[model samples]
Target: MTAPEPAEPPAAEPGVTAAEPAAAGPDSAARPGAEPAEPTDADAASHSAALPGADLDGADLDGADLDGADLDGAEPAGALPTERAAAGVPGKRGRRRVAPAPEPAPVLDDAELRGALEAILLVVDEPVSELTLAQVLEQPAERIGPALDRIAAGYTAAGHGFELRRAAGGWRLYTRPEYATYVERFVLDGQSVRLTQAALETLAVIAYKQPVTRSRISAIRGVNCDGVIRTLVSRGLVEECGTEADSGAFLYRTTTLFLEKLGLNSVADLPPLAPFLPDDVEELADATR
Candidate 1:
């Protein structure tokens, strides 16, 4: 087999002419039309190859190579590029610019809200009130009320051992009646304080209708409640005040300790209640009369 011959260079395009060879490179010896070097230190002492377009402003060569060609006059290709000024063609004035930071989205995730509520509930040694919760969450008190009710309902529906209840004017976590023994083990030092039926009824009435007069309580309950009121007063759950303006009877009200036991911070934290009046027509007629 014959060895292949090296191919000849192609002719330049018709309208274009070839460039004169740069004087700075060793390739000057091989080029057909080489330029003479200027009388300078580079021309007199050194033989170097000149690169076309290497003198462009802001060009960098540290990241590139000139392959032993002349680089002294070059702005290297690796040089940092200049930021272009906004044009009103130089010094005429340009648009004022601002860099904006990325904004986060505003959305309340259900799981996140539930977690926050649960965490708040756990941290409170007593019942957490909706008003206080509203303040903490930076939401309206009305909004907090519905959220508390939903949470309360969820706990009940899930058959959770702990129940959510309102007492002193706040919300509180409590053990169910069936689990009172275990709860009592943690709460009571040794013995439980037993409450009487009369005491319970009186406390319930006072809790439901507070700042009420003794006569009004007597009227509703259909019994003299002086002894029960005394018991409640002694227990620190109820307190007495000046006579009602309408009937001139002593006014009775529940106390802060009542709130503490109920796990409330205020009366507003109590669950919404049904009408306290009897539903029967006879009872309503008798009461009216």
Candidate 2:
């Protein structure tokens, strides 16, 4: 009924017996006296015990390849003994590696702290808030606030007119009240430090319209400020440091002295000027006059 019962499966050739699995001899089979060919905790201990001149302490071979040889269940190339371990020193067992002692907590030297505080005051036109300073330096505000106080006292003791002071949400350098008049007179008379109307206007625009381009300034002022800008450039009152990505336009900004002239420590210290309007254009003209 079945289709001729597929021809009787071919019989084996004479003496060509199916290969029998090689019989595992005593030596090939796992035995109590033989080191377990596979790694086991006990075999690992035994192989490690047999290691010559191998130190276990400080020596680490976890995950080492043994190629199916357990060396008495000791991992192949198991952590060898170290001299320290051999000498009974303690070992770090089962402990994962840790990073080195976090770079000694970065203690700032006195000069570094002092210089940083001074630089902060020099760049800031308004008092730099402790939080802001901390953010800039990537330090804790609490630490920076105290450091600022120390810097202030140092400046005062040295009779420096400008000292660190906090107000309006930041720390700033300001002249001592006692030196205000004298400082004013000096600035007014100093040939190198004279302020001009054009400089003032440019400074105002930069302060108010920061990160602005020359074209924007020209548009707002309704006159070409190229000459005024040049003058300011000559006086070191403004600088062109970079071009805007949009249109590759040149941008301008006020310099530190702009803050100095107004006795201000930061642009934040600048008084909010009244917004100029078409109707106020007349007033601006008269004021310029």
Candidate 3:
């Protein structure tokens, strides 16, 4: 039996330093006097590896390199504006600056504005919201708000008998405190030290919404009614019922005298206030301070 010997290596071409593989394709095969082939992605990556400490972090490892040729000249997806700038990529601008919100235009001339606000205030029993007023006047809320303030300030500056003040989440006209005494005296003339309008209003709230706290009454009436509550208690029309379960605030309710004074047999006999109240009365009560 004879052993076979390994074949000898193939002879190199005259100009080539090494012999090429037998099955090499045209692009892959070595040639005589051929210019250096353009580098492919793998070749470029190998070339980049030889340059140690050179930053290629931002470079595309695939066919799409920093030049972004493979991207059809599009900016790299998800690149921020500043990043695109650093990469020397051109960027289209964003949408034009949104036009500055138009200023609240004048809803009415000064005279008409004052007249309109005053007319509304004079007739309103309860405080009215600026939003409500704005809707009525067909004006923006911003316009209505400032006009109300200016009207309030002007009235104060002129020392008017009545004043425009904000309470119960709204604006209202009230007799100036300095004149409240005179107003009470006139409104109470010849009466048996009777309830003033405020006392009456407070009593009515307790009658309608008994088992409520003093704060609740004030919230509904849009004024601090602590004194009025005390007056009603002293007059035997209201009494402390119990504490509110959650807040532990002292709750008040109408006394038997309340029914007698109103000529009602029971609370259910009291007149319904639906026609005079807003639909969102519960929300109103909650929102008001």
lDDT of each: 0.70, 0.69, 0.76
1 against 3, candidate with superior lDDT: 3
Least well predicted 10-residue stretch by lDDT in candidate 2: 89-98
Name model 2 segments beyond 4 Å from true: 1-139, 146-162, 166-173, 181-192, 219-223, 234-236, 241-248, 255-268, 275-289
Q: What is the lDDT ranking, best to worst?
A: 3, 1, 2
Model 3 deviation from native, Cα RMSD in Å: 17.5
TM-score to true structure, per model: 0.41, 0.43, 0.34
Candidate 1 whole-model C-alpha lDDT, 0 to 1: 0.70
Highest TM-score scorer: 2
For model 1, residues 1-289, the per-residue Cα lDDT tens digits are 9999999999878755555444447544535564443456655334333544434345565767545544333443444323223321221123234448877534445666666777788878765678788678765567666666788899999999997766666776777878977878888879768778888888878877888987778877789989989989999889986778876878888888887876666777777655654568678767677
Candidate 1: Cα lDDT at 47: 33
Candidate 3 TM-score over all chains jointly:
0.34
Backbone N/Cα/C clashes per model: 22, 20, 0
Error of 2 at 127 (Å): 9.4
